[model samples]
Target: MEFYAGSRDACYEAKSAGLPKASGGCLLANASLREGQLLVGGHPFVIGKKDSGNRSSRDYYSHKLAWVSEKFVVLWDEKDKRGWLVNGASALLHIVMTSLEQLSPAFKSICLFDPASIQEGKHPHQPDSATEVLLNINNRQLRIYREDDGPPRFQGQVEICYNMLEKMIEYQLIVLERVRNSRIIVPRAHLEGWDFRHLAQRFDPIYPRLAVLDTNGKSWVDFTRSIHAVTLFGRGFGEIIRPTGACSAWATLPCGKYYLAACAADLQKIMDGHGGQYSTPLRLTDDDIWYIPDKSTGQCLCKDKTDATHSDLAQILLPSDMCKNLSLNPSGCYQTDRGAFIFGFNEIHQWFWNDTGNPFRKMAGESSDLLLNPGISYMSDSSVFRESLGIEEVRDASYLRLVPQQMSSDNYTVGIICALTIELKAVGALFDSTHAYVPSPDHDPNDYVFGSICGHNVVASCLPDGDYGTTSAALAAGHMCRSFNGVEFYLLVGVGGGAPHTNKQDIRLGDVVVSTPKGSKTGGIPYDTVKTLQGGVHIINGYLSPPPYRLRSVLRLLLKSDPNPPKAPLQPYLDQIAQSVDGCGYPGQENDQLFDSDYSHLAEAETCDSCDPQKCIQRTLRPSTQPRIHYGLIASGNQVMKDSKTRDRLGEEQDILCFEMEAAGIMNTVPALVIRGICDYSDSHKNKGWQKYAAATAAAFMKLLLSNVPVSNDRGQRQQAPMFSG
Candidate 1:
């Protein structure tokens, strides 16, 4: 290679621009080359120029920018078959070179330039005896094979052997021989600097045949057929078959066969054993499967019809104390074992038990390893799949992503656990007039609640906001941040507008509204009474949420019997709320209906003065006929229903016992319950005056309910507690 001079100013300019410095000014920038384009520097460039000058054989070589350093720029060309650096000397000098035709297909050689400054070189390379070579693998190692020679001659004689002649990517294979022992074949990459002891940790001694298959079987093609089959062997069972090119293929051992396979790739290779090549030719096939024959069966011993009964399963498995009873009601397949409850048509996954004890209460769906056709599911309105599902090869498109309609709720479904995280963003009063008070600093935020009494319930209120605007924002933030980690069936306890009947029925100003699942039946109601009144009415409108069976039973019992209704005295809480409103700073609006509504004039015999609350009721609002707590249907929609007309419209359509906010958002996200205290008539009369009192009442009721409920502790049991029995 000959030395040539370019421009002295140009060299200084390139150096100042963060490029390598040279005696010649600076190499003019390749205006046509993109940032990542490959190029050769110094010696290769000088050689190319000389070859062209001589008019002899034009150097048939492709140049590539290996990397760049501050003082020196490394470059490679096929013709020179060596790596060289361009420095300030303007001399063609070899630095380090690899005897190879092309770079590894995995990582391409590209110019490294600082995006911040065009003149600055991209990569930082330093002088070192052994350069840290990054091999871009075109083909991955597939299998490990071993051969035994009578009395091994060389012990720990590691030989790096590679089939350089093959068209496929050239990968180094390490062959280690133990004197008079078997020859071990492993990929040079995996065994490099690997401690034999550490390597042994990964290999199980009991399982002689080591098996490494793609966890996310993304490749549709059989592995036995892939041409890029890299094999390794460890005299005995220490064979580690790792894929070098891509981790998409699935590997399996054939029945009664000792050899592992990379059967999918089209390339064919023979297994070289201790004596010679293995007798059987390894090929990729659908039926071919391999496993390290274990004395212990891999089958799950949870006890079923095929093996043990519920009693046997309960005893054989640990944590038997957690399991209570196995209700094999319909069939043995869908039986409920004590610890883990399986709910499905048969063995097919319908849904599994989210045992309360489990940190993440969730149910996993069936997953596949196919890259093209990934698995997916709907979780709280979000599409979920897995990405990069395997060991970084075969790109995984299957990832779980959630997109909720109501981002305000800050609600999201937890994919790992198959549960919803509910945020109770707002539970406040936007005071109209009527002498109602606005939410203030003095008010207790704990007045809000979300949970269940029949079982486990959660109730909470927003932290105080110094300013109303700030308070509202904080409340929204809090609700949006309301996340249920793994609890099953989230509940919301708060206040809502309630219609007052002639006799006030059995409900009072501070009663509870144990809402069913959004679309669940409340009494005879279908639960999804959205638009108009029909033959039967449901509790909620908008997105439907079916209440769990346990709640349904409890509510039914409460409705049937109201002999001793209003179990707790909510009067004190109500009175406190009334007084709090008196301190609010905001003035009443002229159109405030709170002042105009005549609560005293509306008597049992007379009709409602403003909006008729009764017209909204699809059916007669009868007092509880059952002996349990009074549980009525509630409605939930995105919009806050304050108008008596709209309330009546929804009521007549769905027979909603109360109207409140947050439940729809909560229920849609998780297993949620709504407990609302009757504050207003849910009509035009809704005002701030009732908010304090209603909130207090709701809070008290929630405490009463929480004290009496119990949740299952088993780690794999489905939530199945009954609500009531009317």
Candidate 2:
């Protein structure tokens, strides 16, 4: 682990040259990286590699860079085996890391680095002492085995425990895309200081289990046979298990008998307690299943379903409220009282807090842990099964990576971007069926959730939680295009502010606004810049590219086909969503008032409850509360339009029907259409009461829009939208 002195000059800003030939298309002159180690943001990186095999090693690791602007140079720390991402795409030489660390334990390593603070010395060796010396796990202390006068108990409990382990492994493999498999076993373990810390703090209380990750940094397997397992975080890592010196050939396989397994010491204790009587092992049925009584709470109770021998699992597993539903039964199994909303599914995972750690780790010391080994950890895209870890170690070309053509990102023909989590949820509700999670390349930052609508495959994404504004939206759309290049068109669908540019427009809360080309302006957001002149202040408007010809044409066909129809085409979908999910219905006309242009909301209030009702502009009520769809230009900017004066001026001057933060940033990046559900008036009176309903309206319309889009490879103009049935 030695290297020659690399270039001392902070990374050479190679403008137009030195990009790897493999990345020809992404070779934007604004950004470039070379093949060797370069000091970036005072750290180091081995960038732009050609040979994937030579890219990373057991000691060092590499991950795909979703974005690499000259301003934000991501660097790899070979010493710590992690990659560091700088904050903001435009922060050149300003190495301010995002607060991803604060968000979750998974990302606690991401922090503001002061190059001067790094002590250039080895970590002070911790001398092994009485406090540091940990012991081999004693299975007896796990408290998993207990006895009664009847028969040897806990066979059913052990099966549940084994199933719980499998459930944990399955999520890591499919959803988290971290574990290679779940059969990693070791005859012995040498727990160290780090292992002792994680076991006591994270695993011992509730997340009880011993999971092992490969040193090659590939995948992980949980060996929670009976809680005698060690907690090994990927970092601070000391190898616990391996082929010990010689060839230690062992086949780790799943066994059902592991549930009722007993040692000689346990048998003697049982015999002494029961007056020299030999106890028979109880046979459990329904290997690994959880009977969930409340799907909403996601709380469950388990039953062995064999002879009535299983203990009351609900008392141990169910939440406090669930205690009411679970009833005492003669079979020893906790049963949900008759006619309860119970379903059966087997998945038991520790509740996750974030990239950092869970709620349990919050009160503890600031200790970091990589839940999965990077070697086998799939990219952020939850393509957990991206690679197959052979039963034996990889010696040659034995493992084959299978990526189905249908599941490829290229097959996802449409892209949907939501600025908020609520918007994401609204749009996701309309998906006919979600596609399987696929692994993404290292460079792509977006973790796409794929779904289908009327045979159209859509890759949906939302701005990272708590992030908004045009720049973030643009960065997200840029990554979306690069990750899912085959996405023909994108929809920037979410909630926005209503302007009601003209009296005839009749816009209100829970109404849908679509960007439609008017004269020289292709429908999109107009960002107006204030330009001061000698006589008067003039506005210099920045325009963006319109939606693609294909989408605009389809919109026209859709409108024409259902011109003056009996009702709104998206009503059915909106109703379905409202019925399925709570609080996504129309907020009622009383909650949908528009304040006068000069009026302002009462300060420091969450809602308009404190404001004078007289300030609300009186308008003729529509025959029905169904939202009217308006097609016009929208004003987009980085700032929220909360000032009533500015909202009116911009609406009148720019002829804008709606205002939003993200559309302007995305319009230039992709062939995108901006569909906004008017939640607020872009005024001080804006409240969240209408946001969910507004989001629903926008999503409903987008569903209607996509329903009219024929899935066949026809980028040309679409005919009448016969699919629209109001």
Candidate 3:
């Protein structure tokens, strides 16, 4: 084969010699080419060089400056031959040669192709009408057309397209070498006559252009933007991208059966030998559709049953035989002896499946995954699904991605338990803002109100209106612990009866009493005592668990910082609540009254107005309005303390500072600090007037203590608790 560059006469001579003309103004001798020979130009050829005028020359220069070349290749084919023409090969070669000449002398003798050797088919070459050549170069595959077979002419000359052909050969060689050394294990069945060229063509256009086909082979344009498929092999899974760029996974279980999994977990179980079979075997059902949840968006794959045409959002339909062969629950969820196997539905109900037999369907054009229609009560919310599946609830993506490490105990969670709605509201007012409520499966009818206070996540719970006392408190605390897993400590804050004594501490109305350990026992003790006459005296032994050491340390700090605790700054919160017509407001400090234990008078009276002034114990001076905070033991029992003599006796024996009905129960479930605002003196004068102010004071003190506490970190080492002197 002879290759020429420069004049058009050279091409005419080649034609006279009966040689085929190739693109880029070159000719090839058909006879010599059949023997596998290579030919290349010795120098460059300058085409379109016309001497028009000075202005034309400037215009040509401008054109060159503006020219932005594109990547393209030409495809041509004959009766039995086909090849590709690499666009811009000539220009690229010229640039490469110029650069090489300046780099080293060795490049001077390096010829791209030999001109003397006129042998045919000697070097590896791009085959005509071959798919391998096109794939190797990452070019879009196209049908090979011949001159007689189509309107466009076809030509094949090895010498003219030498530069592009050489590059294609180099790329193919590199690919072949990598495959030879690759560690990818292809099964023996797949290895039989495995032609990569054919595979490339088959999977060409891996990404869909305009539309994709559903399981039923029906095309739809508004498909899920990016559906992915992964294959599970052994213990791991791999992603498979089709030529049309649709992603899906395939898994072959140890049972020697292949199945399509909705997500990684379904296939992962089989890999782990954990009976991780698909809810229903793929073979048992026809038109069996599965949806995977997108963890990021909290959305699931759902099918629009109302649409006549098959859509991505429409229910997946499996073969009727497959459905009949498998045993599925009414919801179409797979049920095993262990439990139901619902894929993405395990986490927030991101996906919904419609059983073919179900008569009800979603209304047309409603795209949301949430089942809003009435009568559809079985659909799982994200929390319920995760709980039933024994998986953790899917949290916000930001929290998941940013905090990869497990939550630390240092990340303090403060749980506030209130026995009344007023108490709950008072505590909630201390926080800056409330968090959006996301229902949890473990939480009961009265869900926790979540907020943030002083950088700590505060979860507040209130007992049902009719329920109060230790038993109810224990149940509420238990629910809080289960639902809010990371809660480090709890604060039982509400109103309590003060145990004022003539000696020791002067506990008064509206005073805050905080639970502190006495010796080894907790400050809050259950006084559900049974008086037994042993020999000559009655013995009273109470039940108690020591408060957490960290809480004790915090109490010590709070006392050491202040000699006389000042009234809590809680008026703002009280005022905010008072604005609401249903809210409780301050009952006034004048209403606070302290009566002698010996004095008993008023009966069935709403206020002291009916009582005789002389009967009431007279005082020379009135006590200050500032509420004092006291730290000592608190007695907790099922019954509300009313008699002052009984309160004094218990206070003297146990050195208790206050009495409340809930703390003892919470101690049974969680190590907590009991903060109670003194509403009454545990006397006949007890009334509901002081309950609101007492709750406010306790909540205010809680806020102050929490504000001073350092945020917990992962180190787990205890830090110095904050101290408040007053």
Report every candidate's CA lDDT.
0.26, 0.45, 0.42
lDDT of 3 by residue, 1-726 (tens): 111111111111110111112111001101011112212221212122231122243233123212201111211111111111222222222222222223234433432322212222222221111222211222211222234432121112212223232322222223223333432111110101111111111222111011101111111100110011110011111111011111121111111111111222222322233222354332221122333222122112333234333212122323333344434543333322221121111213222222111112233343222232110111123453223222343333322221112323223377888897667756755553334343555436444555556456567777876899888999989887777777888889999999888247877677788888767556777776657676766555766676677767666766674332323334333433343213355565556567778877478787666666655555433354556778778889999898989888878877878888998789878978888998888888788778877887787678656644554544544333221110
Residue 96 of candidate 2: its Cα lDDT? Answer: 15
lDDT per residue for candidate 2 within 1-726, as digits (tens), equals 010001111222211111111100010101111221122222332233331233243121101111111111112221233211121111111111111111245323332223333222231111111011111022112222234321122122222222222222222222111112221111111111012122212222222112111121110011121111112122221111111121111111012111111112222322233222221111111111122333222122223233333221111112222223444323232222111111111123221111110111111221112211111111232332122111122222212111111378777888999987677767766654444455666786665566666556778887776789988999999988988878889999999999864535889889999998887877775565556688886775667898898888877865675322435456656754564346898878977778787877778989888788888788888898889898888888888888888877777767788888998889988899999999988888888999989999999888778755655444533223221000
For model 3, give the RMSD to the true fold: 29.2
* Deviating ranges (above 4 Å) for candidate 3: 1-412, 442-446, 519-521, 562-586, 619-623, 713-726
lDDT of 3: 0.42
lDDT, candidate 1, at 365: 35
RMSD of each predicted structure? 29.8, 28.5, 29.2
Worst 10 residues of 3 by lDDT: 224-233
**Which portions of model 2 miss their true places by more than 4 Å?**
1-406, 501-503, 713-726
Against the hidden reference, what TM-scores do the models get?
0.27, 0.45, 0.42
Better of 2 and 3 by TM-score: 2
TM-score of the candidate numbered 1?
A: 0.27
**CA lDDT of 68 in candidate 3?**
9
